[model samples]
Target: MIYLDNAATSFPKPPEVLEAVSAALSAPASPGRSGHAASLAAARSIHRARKNLARLFGLPDNSRLVFTANITWGLNTALEGLGLQPGDHVISSAMEHNAVARPLNRLAAERGLVWETAPADGHGFSSPDDFKKLLRPETRLVVLNHASNVSGSLAPAREIKAAVGEIPMLLDAAQTAGALDLSDAGDWLDMLAFTGHKGLLGPTGTGGLWVRPGLALRPLAVGGTGSASESIRSPDFLPDALEPGTANTHGLAGLAAGVEALLKKGVDQIRAQEMKLTGIFLDGLSQIPGLTVWGPRDTNSRVATVSVTLKGYSSSELSAALEREAGVLTRAGLHCAPLAHRHLGSFQGGGSTRFSLGPYNREEDLNSALSALDRLARLKA
Candidate 1:
C-alpha cells in the first residue's frame, strides 16, 4: 500500500525507535519513582529524550522541556497558563487548527477575552504585516500554526513574532517539528508544541512543549511530580511544575532514539529529499485536467503535503476510489482545520484530499499516486 498520510501520523517508524521501545519494556522500570536500577535506567532514558529534543530545537535548558500526551495538551497548557484577564486580546491566524481555535473560543466565552484572527491570502499564507495590524493594547499573546495541515502552507512565524514585539508567541509546530530545520527556534520562538508520532518519527503518546526561560505556565493538573512530595503545592521547577504523575518512560525511550536518528541524518537532508518528491508530485499534478491543486504552488513555501480537489468527486469519494483501485491511502475532509479550509475556499466542498509525503516515501510512491489520480480524473470526465 502507498501511504500518504504523514501529516496525521507517520508510518513505518525507524527500526531504532521500535528497538528502543522494546528495550524499555523488556525491563521493569518506573521513571523517577524509585532509585532502583531499572527505575534509574528509565529516568535516564526520559532525560536523554528531553535533552535530545532540546538540542533539536536549539533550547539551551533541557529542564524546561516537558513531555505531554501530544501537541494538543501542550497548546492547552500554554493557552490556559497565560494569565489573561477579562477584556484581554489574543491574536491567531485564519489558518489555525481547532487546537488553537477551540481554546481561544472557549477563553472568549468563559473568561471574556477577545480573540482576533489575522488574515491570510487565498493560499493560506499569513503575512507579518497582517498580524501587526491586529495588535491591541490589551493583546496578551499571539498564537499561530506554523504550517496548515490542510494546505501545507507555512506561516512566516519569525517575522510575525518580530512584528508582535514582546507579546508572547506560541507556535504549533505539529507539521514541521522533525521535517523542518528548527535549530534557530530559540532565537525567535517563545513557546513551541510538537508531536512525536508525526514528523518526529516516534511512537504515539509522545510529544512535548518547550517554554522559554522566565516564561512560567500554570500547571493544568497538580499531583505527585515525584519531586515535591513534602509539600502539597506542585514543584515550581521547569518540567516538574508542568509534568505530574508517572511519566511515559517507554514512549520516551522510542522518542529519544527517533530524535537521535534525525540528528545523525540531519533535518536539512530529509527536507531536501521531501522537497524533491514534492516538486515531482506537483509537476505531475499540474498536468492532470479537472484536478485543482491547493496551497502554494512553489515547493519552497510549503511542506511535502499536497491537497487537491477533482471535479465530480467529493473528498471522501476520491479517497475511497484511490484506495480501492490502487491501494493508495490518503486523508480526506477538513483535516481538523476548518478555518484553513474556509480560508482556502474548500470548506463548501467538504475539504480536500491531502497527500502528505514522508522521508520513507519513494519516487515510485508518488508516481503511483499521480497515476491513480490521473486515471480517476479521466474516469470522471
Candidate 2:
C-alpha cells in the first residue's frame, strides 16, 4: 500500500533504527538501573540518545530533557506539572489537537482554572495579534501547536514570543519536530512537547519534553526513579523529577538512531522534498473540478500535509476509494482536531481527507494520488 499517513506515524523506518533496537534488547541489563558492564553500556546508550537529541535541538544541557511515552504524555507533563492554581488563566488556540485541548479542558473543569482560545486566520493559523488580545494579566501559561495536525497550518512562534514576552509558552511539536527547523526554541519557547514516532521516524511509544532551566513542575508520578531510593519522596529535579519507573530503553535506542538519520539527511532537505511532492499533488488536485483544498495554499507556510474535500463524496468514501482502487493510503475525518475542522468549516459536513508525506514518499506516490483523485471526480460527476 502507498502510505500517506506519515503525520500520524512514520512507516518504514531506516534500517539502522531496527538494528539499534535489536542490539539494545539483546543486551543483558537495563540502563541507569545497575552497575554491571551490560548496565553501564545500556546507560551509555541512553546518554548518547540524550546527547543526540540535545544536538538536534541545539540544547545546551541534554540532562534537562525528559522522555515520555508519546507527545500526549509530554504535553500532559507540561500542563499538569505546572501546578496552576484556581482562577489562573491558560491560553491555547483553536487549532490544537485533542492532546492539548483535553488536558487543558480537564484542568479548567476540575481545578477552576480559566481557559481561553485564540482565533486563527482563514488558513486555520493562530495569529500573534489574536493571541495578544486574549492575554490577561492572570494568564499563567500559553500552549500553542507548532503545526495544525488537520490543516498543517503553522503558527508564528517567534512573533508570538515577541508579543507575549516572558509568558511561559508550551509548544506542541508533534507535527513539526523532525520536519521543520526549530533549533532556536531555547531563546523563545519555555517548553516543547515532541513525539519520535511521527516526523522523527522512530518506533511508537517514544516522545519527550524539554523545559527551560529553573522551571519547577510537580511530578506526575512518584516511585522508583533509581535515585534517592532510600527516600519515599520523588527527587525534585529535571528528568528524574518527571520520569518515574523503568524507561523505554528499546524505543529510545531506536529513536536515537532515527534522530541520527534525520540529522544526517538534514531537515531542510527533507522539507524541500516533501514540499515538492505537495506542490505536485496540490497543483493536480486544484485542476480537478468540484474539489476544495484546505489550509494555506502556499507550501512555504505549511508542512507536506494537505486536507481536501471532494464535492459529492464523503471524506471516508474518498479515502477508501483511494486506498482500494488507487493503492494510496490517506487519512480521513477530523484527524483528532475537531476544533481545527470547525475552524476550517469542515465540521458541519464530513471532515476533509488528509494526505501526509514522509521521507519515504516519492514523486510516483503524488502522481498516483492525483491520478486517482481525477478519476474519482469523474465518477462522482
Predictions in order: lDDT = 0.92, 0.88
Give the C-alpha miss distance for residue 62 in model 1, angstroms.
0.6
> Which 10 consecutive positions of candidate 2 have the poorest summed lDDT?
181-190
Q: Residue 91 CA error for candidate 2 (Å)?
A: 1.1
CA lDDT, candidate 1, residue 73: 90
Alpha carbon lDDT at 374, candidate 2: 89
Backbone clashes in candidate 2 total 0
- Cα lDDT for residue 286, model 2? 85
Query: What are the TM-scores, per candidate, against the unseen true structure?
Result: 0.99, 0.98
TM-score of 1: 0.99
lDDT, model 1:
0.92
Worst 10 residues of 1 by lDDT: 118-127
User: How badly does each model clash, as a count of residue pairs?
Assistant: 0, 0
